[model samples]
Target: MHAGGIGAPTIARTLNEEGIPNPTSYAKLTGYSWHNRPSSSLWSAGCIYSILHNETYLGTLCQGRQLTPEGQFHSKKNIPKDQWVRTVGHHPAIIDDELLRRELKARKEAGAHNLHEQKKNFPPGIFGKEVRCASCGKILTKGKTLRKTGCERTLFCPTRKKSPSHCKGAFISEKHLESAILHELKNLADRYSDDRVQIGICQDAQSADLIQEKNRLKTAVELIEKEITAYEQRSRDLYLKRATDGMSIDDFNSALSRIRNDVDKLRLKSKRASSELLHLNESIAAESIRMETVLKAADFNHLDKTKVSMLIESVYVHKRDPKSGTQAIDITWKF
Candidate 1:
């Protein structure tokens, strides 16, 4: 179908119309150990598109294309194409290189055309990165609608278009978001200004506590290091006693093993303490910088992209309540 200039969706529809089994069904029929069930026992545009773009049919083996970080089986992140391990002619070719190249080129051209249309329909908005869907945590995409007065902008969860069950009714007007941000900024500024002295006193106490903790961690690390050194020295002494003092080989080995175990434990303790101190220092530095930015944001009466980026970390918009017709907007400030 791709060779005949038929799109993936049309190909999927044709396959379903002919009552052909989808990949999952085919795998199950062929006695493959398939575990996951498809949403429907039918071909989908996504499945068709994936098959069309796959290089494996061209006798190429690709691995390490994605990575699942330690303990995060579900959060697979794509590695860069340059880093992906690919071996050509690793298996019998089902599709010729020429055919695969042509299909890829055609798909790229089609994608470019679709992207142009999308850009024209939905020009980028200021809060594209900063706004998110509270339910799915996906970045809200910018869109616009033509009103009688002008083009009205909105930030909406794009997941609703693909998976409505995940992020339903996640939409907010850009104007409404700006108003909320400005209001929050005003409130924050008033609070800071009104309780400056009390805040300073509290912060001073916190700073002292952090300093004390940092010192304690540093001391612990130093002590652990010294203990490790002592164990190493004892090991060396045992070796000398075995050679010069006629110490039994078994006794020497036993003492050396105990010393090595103690050293390993002390080194682990030292590493933990050092890591804690490093984190504490980083937190102190970040807090100082954030406080400066927060104070600067106090003077902002109107919102701009630059000021928003400086002060706001993220803005999560929850689904609107059907009864009250109100939505919850949660803002995470840098400070």
Candidate 2:
């Protein structure tokens, strides 16, 4: 094969059948563990790429650090192999570790792709949909730092932010936002778990009230219709009296007009009340479903993409600990 030729990803089923490693720790260390349903090609390919480029593959690198566009972007001139901190020959090899390290070095020098990069979905944030820079119409992105410091992701268009000069959208890290949301969730969970907690969410009480209101509205609508019917009858009687010469034309016309206005008012009120009642009923039903979700939410440890989309409004990742070195994701509830 030529040096620049693209390598096709091995089919997932074939990779598993041949006892190649995957993302699962057992698979990565042992070989072919996920039996009933193996990791799909997408996930397996990701794993293969990570393993190949991992400086740790040769036991030569641990936590290989590189600068990002969002971090102190590094240049090729300053980085070296020894300072990279290698721990060679620790694990069994599937590919040539030396080749991987070389490629890794080259790629790192080029400023693209990483384990963390894998976490971000390509094509960037939901910008054209969610928020815009108002100025440049370009999407704002996460912050830049002198070193590997955590910054929130911002939403602004590239043209606006980078600018031939239209918008330098104020950027914020999604990370910080995410952390706040996570803290809120954890706090809420703890509060619910407390044995001595006295507070009630009042959902049941609220539901009862909603039901009562709906009934009241129905009754009110009936009364309104009765009033409207009375007014309608009065209008007809006045018109008939004038036509039969029982009342003056002026008096008949005035009385009929007044009665018609009353009937119209009553009808409008009845319609509004009916709509409100319907909405109240719908709200109660929705709340019931929401409470059920809350009750069952404890079962989930990790939220998959689909679930997160349905249940969460947005996710924010923020505030990296310099010491601990782990990223946190904060998810906002849809509510």
Candidate 3:
């Protein structure tokens, strides 16, 4: 339950990234204005199923469990949360203790936590990391506007209070910003049709042919092994000299421990590199193909929002680009 705990919007975003299929539940992305789903036991049951089976709330990684023959379990088992092995520090978890408890409470009372009254009211465009309030240095938030005037994206000072200080609550009209963004975005869309972007990535991928890539990886592994062997020999020589000369065991042991730790790290890195290389070599052609596909698509629609979302990390608006009036959109995507 760090900023926004696992919620309906989280479910939608996860599906979008993983290519899972689900019928729309909200009228818009990151919106609570429900799409007015057809009321039926079937819908209610699905909601119940989604709540019960979802793994996000538990902070546990999941893989579909499989069974084996000889009456033995395969690589999968639904172990308890306490026993599940976790990869520490891999990624931020969506859920924590408090949200998990509250979610169960809400589900027991209502059908799902979603039906519970929202705790934090926010503005719509403020849903993502996009809106910045020029005043508070905080991203503007989304919420329902008073007088039922539809969603308003706004900036506010939470330090003052939860209630909106509409007096100081300055907002960028989303329509106007989207208009400005689109005006610049059109060129990005035009860049979609540019072939050179695709060509550059394709050329890079092609430069490292699959067989050559595998060989290079193997060579790197061999070099790491050579370094490890050399280090071990050096440590051994130090130990023998110290033994023959009656050197201080404390100093000798300290040096030996440091050397051993280095060796251990080196071995681990070597193994990791080797494993990574094996996977990459296997998928070299496939990844190259995927890159080619993305390149072609990027060339086709350089500025599509969805495509832009994948490739671009940030777009810096520049005064020079605006002044020029030609190539006014100064843009950079991982291109």
Q: RMSD of each candidate?
A: 13.5, 20.1, 21.1
Q: Backbone clash tally for model 3?
A: 12
TM for candidate 2 is: 0.41
lDDT of each: 0.77, 0.53, 0.51
Which pairs of residues clash in candidate 1, taking residues 3 or more apart in a chain or in different chains?
none
Choose 1 or 3, whichever is better by lDDT: 1
Model 2 C-alpha lDDT per residue in residues 49-101, reported as the tens digit of each score: 66665555555535334434555557524345546655566665555766665
Compared with the true structure, what per-residue lDDT tens digits does model 3 show for residues 1-335?
A: 21244545444334444543343443333465465655311112235347545564456455333334556655444556655555443455555646666766665676445334443454224123433443343444443334467555433332112223211333434443444554554554454335533432433334356556777778888998998998899899988989799889898988899889988988998998799787876576565555554445434422334654654444332222346553222234453
| Superposition TM-score, candidate 1 onto the true structure | 0.46
Please tell me which model should have the higher TM-score, number 2 or number 3: 2
Worst lDDT run of 10 residues, candidate 2, spans: 1-10
**Runs in model 2 lying further than 4 Å from the true structure:** 1-203, 317-330
Task: Give the per-residue Cα lDDT of candidate 3 at 81.
Answer: 62
Worst 10 residues of 1 by lDDT: 193-202
